[model samples]
Target: MGNINKRGSKDLVVDSDQSQQDSPTITVDNQLCDAIIKEDCSTIKALLRSHPVNQPLTILTSYRLLFEQQTCTVIPIHLAAEYCKPRSLLCLLEHGADPEVRDTQGHTTLHLMLLHWPIVSSTWTKPGNRIQRLMADIQNNAVSCLHILFQHGAQVNAQVGNSNKYSPLHLAITYGTHPILSLLAQNGAQVNAVNESSMTPLHMAADILNENMIKTLIACGANVNCVIPHNGNTALKLAVCTASSKAGQLLSAGVGCIRLLLIHGAHVNAQDHEGQTALHEACCGGREAIINLLLEFEANVNILTKNGESAIYMYLQRSSNIRDLMVLTRLLYCSYPLRLTNRQGVLPAGIMLPEFQLLKETLVRLARKPLPLEDICKKNIRNIYGKKYKYYVRQLLPGKLWNSIYNCYDLADVLKGDL
Candidate 1:
């Protein structure tokens, strides 16, 4: 009895090398791969009785693999999602396959489904009949796969990679439909989730001027004031700096985007890591409408960036504004600080186009004269509210005595008198 107790019939511990030698290899899972190709869940279930449900099997896909001639490493769930095989996916999930298992590219099953889906930028309108049919079929297939994965407990907010860290919400903005976005948001995907580049879905929305996406994101409690990583760019700044030229589609939407951003309490004067503000970006881009809206929200013309470049300096960089001079008139009306200079102590007149000698002289004269009393009071009120001045301006200052001055001050009329 003592001998049997001390020296057990079975070995006390399994050898590491022996376990490794006994484990199944890529070549050993040929049956699993064949079942995945046929989406034969019955065979998969039968096989899973003897093997692991989450075993890495080789399969042939159009993109990653081809046929009997080629193959790539993927678990059953990945193969199912990649092929939009919801039944196969559900089967694997039912058998306890991990829904969040990543592919070679670090994409989860949801990522595989999303990456292959086609997106037409004009989500509101349908295209030609042929394209529309194609889109509908694709949308159904992709959406079904997403629903199955979600039902199986796949992470809605699961990021793509360890280093890249792009959330599913970010991908949905580009490749996903409103249903996918809604599903993710409803299932607790962080609306404000930041990627490795410190970009949020709101930033992408602003870049593309997707008004619907912007409104939806903000309604879901997105931070309009959130900035990017290195450059620290806010959504409003990105909106002002929108550089898209898609048949002028995105260009005309600039005013609407800035309006939405400003109305929702985006800081008009929110500075970047380099201390540049949205007004500066608008000025640089020569965006008259955007600049006007920024000024209406009380963007400080006197705010100098880290390089000591004021809005006046930025406005002059665009050659198109030279003939118009409307920007100069607006700057004067908004009480752009007169004596503010660049890093080298250079005033606007110092680099002023010789063609506008008359305006240069006027600028010099304005610098000598004191700012108007009304302008002084307005500046003081704005300063009191600091960065959060937009709310108070709409509520308090537009009261009894100065309502006309606050709300209806004529820009052209005021500039004519000053000049």
Candidate 2:
């Protein structure tokens, strides 16, 4: 059998039966590649001028010369951008290289620039200063390179990469090209452009938990409530589900991202395709802080997903250990409706492990009891004053008194019985 490779519109074949020595080799002009790497404009110009017009040579030609064995076709401008060679990039554009030319993977020069940006180590030490200087220079050059491409009529909103259909802004946010994100926005990149998955760049930012990028997109007028079309996931829902950590290890920035989105008017109770809200996602995460934050923002604990699963049901079903029992207790404290059943008709209590019998009994007892008069007053105040004022009310009340009113009882004593 012969091995087939696709390059641009052409297909090259290699015989698998051929020995390594018997295979034909393709050679590229090393000097042209060297001139590009060194950013030698004069040499590049000379080389281009010397090549016959009939040959139709280009920067892509130079790239092919160096990497003939590469199955993926990349253009010279792509290389310049990847290497942060601003001078070479500008020179190529001046010489009529297409800034919008996509590689085999459908990444334009702009996509490559941000996607392959140099990684800078955070460790501060003796060699760090020099590395930091180099990073700064590369970043500045990358910014300049982006500006040049934009000025030369690059498509600011063109979707890149074959599978992802990511707009340049999406790439910028995904790759941490912070400065380029703002520049792209200012240069008329579509802030709310959806990828192949119908996810906007804001969704991507939320998934990565980049609060600054989220702010940048929101300031640029990216819709905070923009929902993925297929699944109907808003940025807030994504933030809750895709948060980079689990439970106690939850990233503060991720929580802050969710809070920021909510403040900016991301729909807290916005449901996905499955009718699950951000609160449902937080329960699945089993993170008390996120669950608390969502509840504070008025996320409905009793809202049922398409499967008829409430946030409390999700918490009990997904929670792995006693540590998460406190999260369940907190949900109970919030007065999550206890009588609700899932699509399977199983109540939250029905899913309890034998180990959680005490916790389950406690929850059932609390559910049957009426709210104390003080708690009713506080709940009314909380509802009237809104989520932000609840904190102030807590501060004004004595610690013991407030805990009692909100049913903020500790679960440690129950857990200690098992210990």
Which candidate should be chosen as best, given lDDT against the real structure?
A: 1
The residue pairs found clashing in candidate 2 are 28-65
The TM-scores of all predictions, comma-separated, are 0.75, 0.77
- The top-ranked prediction according to TM-score is 2
Tens-place lDDT per residue, model 1, 1-419, is: 00111111111122233434443653345566557646788888888887687877643323213222334556777766665666677888888888888876788888767765545445436545665766555556667878887777889888998686889988878765555667778778899998888899999888877777888888888999998879989998887788323322344667787789889999888899888988887777665666777877778877888988888777765545544356666565455465446788776543366665655566667667787787777656544443345456566554664443444346444444433
Off by over 4 Å in 1: 1-40, 43-52, 60-69, 120-131, 243-250, 348-351, 371-419
Q: What is model 1's C-alpha RMSD?
A: 12.3
List, residue by residue over 171-277, the lDDT tens digit for candidate 2: 88876545567899999999999888888889899987878889888988989998888888889888887662563254454878888998999888889889889
Tally clashes: model 1.
Answer: 1
Clash totals, every prediction: 1, 1
